[model samples]
Target: MNLVESEYQMGKSKIFMRESQKQKLDTQLHQTILSRIIVIQRWYRTIHQRRHFLNFRAMVVKIQAKHTAMSI
Candidate 1:
């Protein structure tokens, strides 16, 4: 079957499996969680980078306008 179905079967068979099977399942679960967390962190990093760039641009514009006003 599929990954989901396989995982479901593993869950249902938990009481019958050997120690090795349990460890394997746990390792798979950990890897899945870690990968998802990495994806989320990368997504947040990109969003923060974009926001920082926009803020920097805004500050630059404000500073230029202030200098122009002072010169006028």
Candidate 2:
């Protein structure tokens, strides 16, 4: 099965698993959760980095304009 199906299956199994068996499932679930968390974190980091770069460019343009105005 694909990733989505596997995740769904694991989730359903987790709800029905006995307490003793839960630990094993918990480990598997944690791995999946951690990986997904990393993906999300990386995505947000990229977005923030791009925004920072754009803001820096805008600031540079404003500073250059101010200097040009002072010179003229």
Candidate 3:
């Protein structure tokens, strides 16, 4: 039989398939979820690192200003 004819059945609001088909779909779903999670994590890390760098730069500038004022 063809894949469409043998692999699944359609009900009013759901499609039913064999265990192997379910496993295949589950694996694909997990992979997609993991990839999205990685993207989100990378974005969060970039924002966090950028904020930390800006804070450090501001502190350095403040210290330099104080040192220059004291020397003058």
Q: Top model by lDDT, which number?
A: 3
Model 3 local distance difference test score: 0.89
For model 3, residues 1-72, the per-residue Cα lDDT tens digits are 233557788899998999877777888889999999999999999999999999999999999999999999
**How does candidate 1 fare on TM-score?**
0.69
lDDT string for model 2 (1-72, tens) is 112333333454454434545566677889999999999999999999999999999999999999999999
Q: lDDT of candidate 1?
A: 0.79
- The superposed Cα distance between candidate 1 and the true structure at residue 5, in angstroms, equals 14
**Each prediction's RMSD to truth:** 4.6, 6.8, 3.1
Question: Relative to the true structure, how large is the alpha-carbon lDDT of every model?
Answer: 0.79, 0.76, 0.89
**Model 1, total clashes:** 0
Q: Whose TM-score is higher: candidate 1's or candidate 2's?
A: 1
Per-prediction TM-score to the true structure, in the order listed: 0.69, 0.60, 0.86
> Which is superior by lDDT, 1 or 3?
3
